[model samples]
Target: MRLSTYEIILPLVGTDEKPIEGYTLLTNGLYGAVDVVPKEDADKLQAGDFAGLPAALRERLMLRGHITRKDEAGELADLKLLSRIFKTIQGRSGVGLVIMPTYDCNFRCPYCFEQHRLKKGQDWLDNTMSDEMIETVFDALKDYRARGYMVNGCSFYGGEPFLAKNLGVVKKIADKCREMDLSMGAITNGYDLETYLDFIEEYKLRSLQVTVDGTAELNDRRRLHKDGLPTYDRILRNVELALQRGVRVNLRVNVGKENLHGMKDLIDDLKARGFIAKEEERAKEEEELRKTDPQAKTKRGQFSYYFKATTDDAHPEKNISEQDTIDEMMKIGFTAEEAVARQSQYNMIWNRMKNLFKKEGYPDFSPAYCGAEMGMLVVDPFGKVFSCWDVVGKDDQATGYIQPGMSRFLWNFNKAKWRTRTVDLIPACQSCPYAFICRGGCASRSSNAYDDYFREFCGEIREIFAFTASRLAGQEWEKRRAAAAAGEASMDACAGELTLSLAGPASRFTEAERAKIMETNSQKEMFDIVKGAAFFPEPE
Candidate 1:
């Protein structure tokens, strides 16, 4: 079955003629799937919008404004600043380093992209970055700094970011960055988040993300230990601790077929735990007070939030009944972890939110999911640069290097003739409307000289995009019952759904281009696939 769940908020909530615009998300729970949909006005939609939608599900929509996908040369809104700083500092959009302290993982998730990298086998008891090697990365960073710009802050990526034994060295690297580092963040699996809560709080991490695939059964099924055993108990325990510790968690979920039905389960669980609601009245007040008084004593705030951390002045009145469930969950010894994870359960169809902004006079429509354009970079602990782990080190995934004593390696770049050959470049993606935003997708999926399987891989992505678009357009009129809370608005432009079509200026091709290119051309096919990947479920 298909679900076109959307998150929308219109100012004219009380009016019978409320306007609607934004993208929608289409989910295929059968496959634990998700994808982006195009935007449509509330008035533009036909009565068919309500065809298959159940009445109880209509009022839970969550909507948001759009973000930018253009260069940062001119001053833009603060939200675009995230991407602007990335390109400005690194001469590209995504130049932050994603240093994996280690490849060793404690658990095994079925869908993990790095499953081939193995969860264990590497001796964690001694495997770690040495002081000398750590300095090598830092020394190389100087070259990045010389490139002129504070690349996106450092990214700690790994089997589990905190599980790396060199936690102390990672700390030192962060400290050194104080003189030139932009900011620091992480994408951990949430296994050791509690044990390392101090690092999160101490660094005041910009975004410390953790992934939990689904509710207990599905989550355990998708994400588990090396022995194929469930790890729900410990992971949840850690999440509980992290939440109580005051560290904001970017809970990540990669929905797939097996966990499709778990959506409501997770949402219900979080609501019951209060982890998704405002903190106790006291906690909400403390959160407000903390803004002015850093020295204020630790007091629980009145509210805890599970809303999108955005620049938009939009807040939906959380479900009142949902709030009550949280109160109940707390009484039985269930920790805030359930709430934290559950908060992410709301099936937000980004299309509605994006369409909302489009109707609000959005200025630009650059598609920006995440990448390393020039100003942005993803650095590995070993000092190598990549767009992101999902896009680097493949046979076709290498751009440049920030070597210790080197001026820097431009690897292979010549924009004017960037595609003299088809294999080295994707002749199909240049013309994509989402091209600028997706940057030819990931480098590994290139078909020309990059990967022999580029076509097949990208073909799969295109299929996903097509599925999402239909859903968003199909649900044009259905309205949710909730209203925007307070204080969440923004000024960024809305880029509609990034389709997987080969239509932008990037699609031109030479007659013999295919014959001249090598089979290992990696960057070619990967670009288009990732643009539409905003909805891609990560490996469990």
Candidate 2:
């Protein structure tokens, strides 16, 4: 038997007051199991040198998948299985329609990538999506529904989706989604949200991802209006109103050198304004709301914040290293663990895996990382369709387009390329231990910035994973010890069920289709990293 590729091993150290020996922490990234084993046994198991270990110990490892009899060919087979499962899921999943109604945003944030284009005298206002294009989007959605796919939801995107000029277009799309019983979400600047309360309630807008940057005073310096007016207070008020009406508000802060430290202040402001509530407090409030008014939408769906490190390849002067940005969060107030977790997407996944958080069930295992694949398409203002929001404005990135009188959408290889981007297909990721979780990292971002699908801004993904696993392992160990002291039989017995399941109709794949996917072809060779066409020209 051999260890799984997803295993992460770390030295099991004792408390700071004392020292312990002959133990190591073995964690399985896939199965989410952490165990402390004798150093000698660990060494033997790792080296496939199981000579002196007891049968019980060996059986336990094998059952947990810490040790498996699988050979290299078996490992490859597992990956193929996973890839097929992903493809099956992708085939049946709901189609995400991201509509960019306009390219003109009111915000004049200095760090915005689009601002560089604005300075170059680009007439983005004139490029707004025509009414005919909006009609085309509805036609496309109908086509998807006719093809046996659910029109899952609509996401309103663009320069600033909430801009006054775009309100009519927003209302049109929102009304259509409501008519079809689909949820609606938006990525807006949040300045004019007060004007959309009717649309929000009538259309059942579920979520709004708005940028706050930092606290009121600090954020106002960057997230300003086109006329240089401060927008912090207006945004805060609007977000608060949305929360009161049962909308989930996600405050996306662009963490950089300037606003990194200010994040703490912003978080504190949110706490004071009732945007964040402690677990017990939130539970009490929710119970009270249920008792008083059973039909009320929410009592705890206020808002939460996420941090993204600022990057502007079109203007390198605005970029900051991920390490530096994360360090600033730690220097200000967050612990190293919190800093790392909050700075990344799906931060709750770490806690869920470690058995600390349980609000949502364990994450469902799916190969699709983002909307770029699985037909989550973006229809730009000009009727150009791209695979993801990140590639909207670039003409070269558009997978297809709709002409004024065309009865159907055009097709391209870009959409097909993204459709096949599974973890096993990435050259740099194929042999990497964290391939499943990383999932080849934002394809458009990697391709745009580094001209390679697997490359990231920092290549420190492994380090981040290692740090996260170690911290979670330590937390789990302490919890188990506490349970033992309290006379519990074992922590595992009370830890509740954890499930890992594949997505969609894998059982229904025809043998012919399976054989075609299983064949070794040019698609396999496409994994090799290579720079091809530059979608955008260099700035003068």
The C-alpha RMSD of each candidate to the native structure, in angstroms, is: 14.5, 8.5
Best by lDDT: 2
How much lDDT does each candidate structure score?
0.43, 0.65
Local accuracy of candidate 1 as per-residue lDDT tens digits, 250-306: 665555434544555765776676655644554566667779997563422122224
Report how far off residue 503 is in candidate 1 (Å). Answer: 19
Output candidate 2 Cα RMSD. 8.5
Model 2, span 58-100: residue lDDT tens: 7666665566676655555555655654455333457778888
User: What shift in Å separates residue 270 of candidate 2 from its native position after superposition?
Assistant: 3.3
Pairs clashing within candidate 2: none
After superposition, which runs of candidate 2 have C-alpha atoms over 4 Å from their true positions?
A: 11-23, 28-40, 90-92, 115-124, 271-283, 289-296, 299-301, 314-341, 346-348, 351-365, 404-408, 454-458, 490-540
Q: What value of lDDT does candidate 1 attain over all alpha carbons?
A: 0.43
